[model samples]
Target: MITLSAFADEISPLPEEQIDVLARHGIKHIEFRSIHGKNVLDLTDDEHAQFRDLLRQNGFGLSAIGSPVGKIKITEPFEPHLDRYAIALKLAEFYSTPRIRIFSFYMPEGDDPAIHRNEVIRRMTALAGVAEAKGIRLFLENEKGIYGDTAERSHDLVTAVGSPALEHAFDPANYLEVGQDIDSAWNLLRPQVGHFHVKDYCTKTHKNVPAGQGEGQIPRLIADAVAHGYKGFCTLEPHLVVAEKFYGFTGPERFGDAATALKTELNARDVSFA
Candidate 1:
């Protein structure tokens, strides 16, 4: 069965509210990104303990640590970012999840990503080593302006890293935003994808929409993956109310809408989700 999870903080900054919304939507897991307006990497020890207790009480497991592990610029200092990656690993263990979402570093604007390819691979390799040592899987997300933003580059980074610890976090809307056809990107990255972020994109309006409402072609992707026996987390990352570089907001009601949109797709395909 595909497990249903979400970036619950998109519903509210408060942890309690985040849990409440997820429970209401029948989502038993969360892609833990933030709580109390703080990133998961920045959560203090006490806060971590408290949040764990809350999750335990609410009967929620974690799908992954939604860490910004590789969102740094390719030119930024690396040692500090590695320390942050360590924290993300710790959170993954604390939550008893083997998954941590990451990214390929951003290339300088207007420059060909090839110029930064070697550096990105070096940094990614270093990170993958840590994940491998810790027995954690890193789901490298393809984000706009990032080196792995395209299916081809994402395939390259995953192949070059060549680590069992590294895999792809496929986001159809992201590919659409970058002008890649969703079907083509899916075909290219299907073998490497270990996670999914459920959001749709309207090519005509250049806006994010709920699943099946736009050009993302989400239902077909879901049907295909299920037919292929893909069992994994499909995390709802609805940027319905606001889509920003660092964070997004959908609010409680729209977050519910996003969940419904995803559930509808699953239902149409006769797929079960927990």
Candidate 2:
């Protein structure tokens, strides 16, 4: 229960290298973010073929399309991004996974996120409709500065959308970064969490860290999730090397460290997992 997966591209941009590193850690699943230094959404038809071949040859499975589908400026045009989301949906279908990780659009600097709520809801509802029609599920990640970044706003989006196709992808580190109360956040978001992300943030150093070693409250959350009969993929977004507002990086060694740290936390919770 509570199986583990990772954004393997953080290990290396090269798909083959990413696979090799994951295999060494006994990981069979990866959040398909990028391969060969290209974003997943940017991959061409030929590239998709090659990516599939590599995954098959290496005995790996995809957890979700780790797409930057809505990581755009909120004030920018929406039509183009909706088209991009269509591409992400196709990729998810092609990879045989209903899981697709996405974000609400980022708010313009110093803009009140609440002011954009109506627009965010409209766009999210549209995307949810597409997923429902196509038999896929969308996991909305709570990235900072986005309209749905906070736990309350995140719950609101899921509630307002009123669709099973759309739900939450819980990330404790992200919550902590915004000074949210984890207990309250968990209580509110728990019912809607479709997937979990593994990462930790150090308040003291203000940097990313391995799970269970910082302000993420990972162990407590894991125990609670399992106690509540929750079982699903906990996608690793280690951000070990170069975590920025938009992207992150980590090599094979650091990625392995990140995976091990998460495994350690799970083990302590007496949770059986890969």
Candidate 3:
């Protein structure tokens, strides 16, 4: 029963029309990226409350707060990031979402990866302490141009943090971006995975494609996670919203195309979205 969700950012800026689109597509859960076209830290209390009310009225639940917490240089001290995390936690409480997506940020130029690695673990652990007390889980997503881009590094960072509050948000296409085989990457990060991102990529061009149309081996990835007993949401972060220049279509058209492809794939594999 892996519930399918989508990022609000994919739909962009929380428009009323987007809610209608999501409702039409039967998308009941969303991981909010930002509120009122700003980061979570910048959202005021009134805006947060209004956002929550909108979701409630629209029959949507906030799957997680997609906070850009700590997605900066590792050399930068943790204090500034901590402030943002605190704000994110408050918003998470307001929205009644139990999870937040965080990052390992970029490694500083000409610095030892080892030092940056330790700093990330230390900072994440401190954040995890606060999150644990607040009853929230911080999920570290592997992204390109970041220290934890690969399965191995992300696993090591999670191991070093050693907090139950900290877990992995697995994204296969991200591994593909860094030139890792999706199957091997999944095997490496299987033990630490707490959530998932559903996306696909063109192996040669490194471009995003519809979920089942790329070289990501999505069926195998989903099967592996199911076999490993991953009982969490497989949220769709479809980067397929960019239209071809020649076609002059909008982002939603691309997203709708991707959604159709994903629905077909899931049907063929007997994976029910509900």
lDDT of 2 by residue, 62-84 (tens): 99999998899889999988889
Cα lDDT of candidate 1 equals 0.90
TM-scores vs. true structure, each candidate? 0.98, 0.97, 0.92
Native-to-model Cα distance after best TM-score fit, residue 103 in candidate 1, in Å: 0.7
Q: Candidate 2: lDDT over CA atoms?
A: 0.88
Global lDDT of each model? Answer: 0.90, 0.88, 0.77
Across residues 179-245, which tens digit of lDDT does each residue of candidate 1 receive? 8888789998898988888988898888888988988787788778878888999899989999999
Q: How big is the positional error of residue 197 in model 1, measured in Å on the Cα after superposition?
A: 0.6
| TM-score leaderboard ranking | 1, 2, 3
Candidate 2's clash total is 0
Cα RMSD, each candidate: 0.9, 1.0, 3.3
Off by over 4 Å in 3: 110-112, 241-250
Off by over 4 Å in 2: none
- Between prediction 2 and prediction 3, the one with superior lDDT is 2
